[model samples]
Target: MVSLRLRLGKAGRRWLLLFHRWAGIVAGLFFALWIGSGLVMLYVPFPTLTETERLARLTPIAWDQVAVAPDDALRAGGAVGLPAAFNLEMRGGEAVYRIAGRDGNRATVSARTGARLGPLTPEGALRLATEGLPDGRVEPVERDQWTVTARYDPLRPFLKVALGDPAGTELYVSQVTGEIALDTTQFERAWNWVGAVTHWIYLTPLRARPELWRTILLWLSGFAALGALSGLVVGIWRLRLRRRYAGGSVTPYRGIARWHHLFGLAGGIGLSTFIVSGWISMNPYRWFSSNAAPAEIRAAYAGAPPPLGLDAATLRGFAEPGTRGLRFVAIGGSWWIVTDGLAGTQGRRAADGLPLTVDAITSAAARAVPGGALRAVEPLAGFDTYWYPHGADPRPLPVLRLRFDDPAAIWLHVDPRDGAILQRLDLSGRINRWLFDGAHRLDLPGLTGSRRLHDAAQWILNLLAAGIAVTGLVAGWRRLRRTLSA
Candidate 1:
């Protein structure tokens, strides 16, 4: 042992130092690129328009005045110039008919008012569709009712909606007024095309497989993380370099190199963790569902009541105090509120009374989860724990939304009349939940920062990996050069 230690003294240290330096230098650029791209992805929101935004874009028509049958409306509008894939919708309140074309063209006409709202032009529709917006056309194939044939543009394809046969369409007749408050066929062919493009990233001219891209990037990131870990080990082995050059007298390049080493040593583990987690997130389905069985999912759903249909207007009244600027209302047997908060935080709420206890089948009035429960679960159930490694259970307690300090929380309200638990899911978890969720969501502001940091770490790690890969190359090159000189 003594002899081994002696042998490993100065010579071993020097070799280790060399290893660390070269490894970092080699992997630096690739790490930087990954970090930079990640940062951009973090902040860039997905291409989707909110319901209110959709409403604002089109004109409002009254609920009472739909004059023409859907088929008649299509006939009145003239020959169907666009392809088969189009969609239509009827907006409530004002009997407004909305026609959406495949490419994202949209036109709104008042059913009662008989006034034409502005049309979403083909160019505008194209832009929206390319960004993954929904576009389709609607026509009344029958009398008194409309048959909305939603089409997918062959130009841009999407996984959500198959091409040729568009996604499903909805029909609504005004309950108070006899008029068809909503019509789906008013938009032109150009509009439908644009909408189709907006709804799918794959439909874009430069289509790339999202899942495949995500998988590739994740694997690349994993490799980069490994490189980083190795570099860190190498860096630690060479601590003397920093001590030897601590004084200001050291050369400028040496000083910079020393600082780099210092940073890498301190930040390496953290960088590795982030990168690994990010890779895991990219393929959450694979990781999370690996351990989750259909049995388990069915079991979870079994205790729950059958889904219910909710009244959006009623839900709005209940959710108003907790949420503001309601964006979308998801109605089942219960209602969910998607809203912006008074603070910068986004909000979500369900009707008061969702029974959380596993055995209970009935819902109580919707109440916020108590503070103590939130405090307890926040650390465990937060995104940091729940979102990664796929199936790992970071068991969290049920907490109510209004009471939790989190900026966002899903509210599951159970209507007293029915046993359904209303589920309201926000893009972000509650404010407290944001700490974990924000890091994962590319929609949040920190997405860019987190991605950048991860990328930078990856680049540094990749350089280190390259160094390892080229170790033999380096040795060969030096030996060849020496032979040439001799």
Candidate 2:
């Protein structure tokens, strides 16, 4: 038993040494890459044309040209599902009605006539594809995944149209929607390989198999975290401020070895936290954080329809020239026309067209939560404790805030459009947004307006950890070479 214990200790040390040695060699490159790429990502986001951007690029809709009303468009669409919302928007300067079903299906029909424009014509597709180019020259359209993946799933079977520009730009125009889904410049294409692709191991070949990539990353990060921890332990054990082994200095090891040991000791906690947070980000089941499901949101849209006599013509007259869309939401036997955008701004209900009384809206909102009772109903004039905008998730201004009596202490930000709850912040959501987001991204509420300072702080800490990664890589390489020679 004594012999077994001794052998076990030797084996444990051997394995731990090997594990740390190899994890550093492998994942150190990724660590450097993740930090560098993360810095780049902060500035240049993955290419996406937002709705506001799309609207800003287009001209105002011709009210005279819109002969077919939304009612006519609905009939023309031949929609099998119940219409939840009717939206009027310009696509390439042509007005179209986008009818959304409660099941998340959307059908687009021409506003000029009640005809269903199923897909873009070849000519139409080519025209949109070349819109971005200064000198219009184009190659023949082809059906392929040239500028598509799971990310562009909504806009699939794309028409790949290569431009004749010097940069070799290719635009992916959606065959279904007849819209420019993605625009890839030569610079964006080249830099992306170095930035996101190498950082994520997200080559088309590997990225296509999402599950495999996820599994590989999870295991890699796990071992890397373990390696950082082990390094911390080893660094502490080897630390002797007075005693000297190789060099007659405080640190036993000389040069790079000493640098590696000290940095590991200093940055081990951060390395572990960063790597563990990265792993947690890939947790789709959201075991670590609360995820708001669509089903849970549907709890608010329950019960019978609220009866309010309203129609498209009345809503149309209420719309601004730059209005993007309109939605007729019924709440508590009252109706409202939610006018979306008039030249890039927050949506608002029509003047004198109120949906439900404040009391009625609060009561209805309370009923949305299973056991919730209305606690306080206040008008959120500006950013408050629970209803501030974060990243791309926008908070519509002039919102109706409803506090509830549920154990979770749910707060719903109801859109003035039709008393529809735009945001729901329960205890779990607060924990996820405030606690998890604050720690993982270093986005504390105190630094809300001071983004520049936050970024500077982030860069400093990340650069320190990066120093550790660099030293570990160099040390691991030399050690591997030594082991091979022995």
Which model scores highest in lDDT? 2
In order, what lDDT does every prediction score?
Answer: 0.36, 0.65
lDDT of 2 by residue, 258-347 (tens): 787777667766666676666656663555333332444444543345332334455467577676656555444334555656443333
How do the predictions measure up, each by TM-score?
0.40, 0.81
Score candidate 2 by lDDT. 0.65
- Candidate 1 residue runs with Cα over 4 Å from true position: 1-27, 38-46, 67-207, 240-256, 289-486
**Regions of candidate 2 where Cα sits further than 4 Å from its true position:** 1-15, 83-85, 128-152, 160-171, 180-190, 208-210, 241-250, 288-293, 302-312, 328-335, 342-352, 355-364, 371-428, 434-436
Summarize candidate 1's per-residue lDDT along 1-486 as a digit string, tens digits.
988888888677676656544444444454554444433333332233333344343332222344533333333333143311112233423344344433354344444444555433333333322234345333222222121122222112111211122433232222221122232322322343333322221233233345565565666666655666665776565566454544632322243454555555556655555555555555545533222213322223223222223332343343333332332222222323333333322323344534223222222222233221222122122233223211112222332221123343333323222222333333332332333233333224433335465445445644543333344234434545787799
Best model number under TM-score: 2
Total backbone clashes of candidate 1, pairs 3 or more residues apart or in separate chains: 84
User: After TM-score superposition, what is the CA distance of residue 414 in candidate 1 from its true location, in Å?
Assistant: 9.3
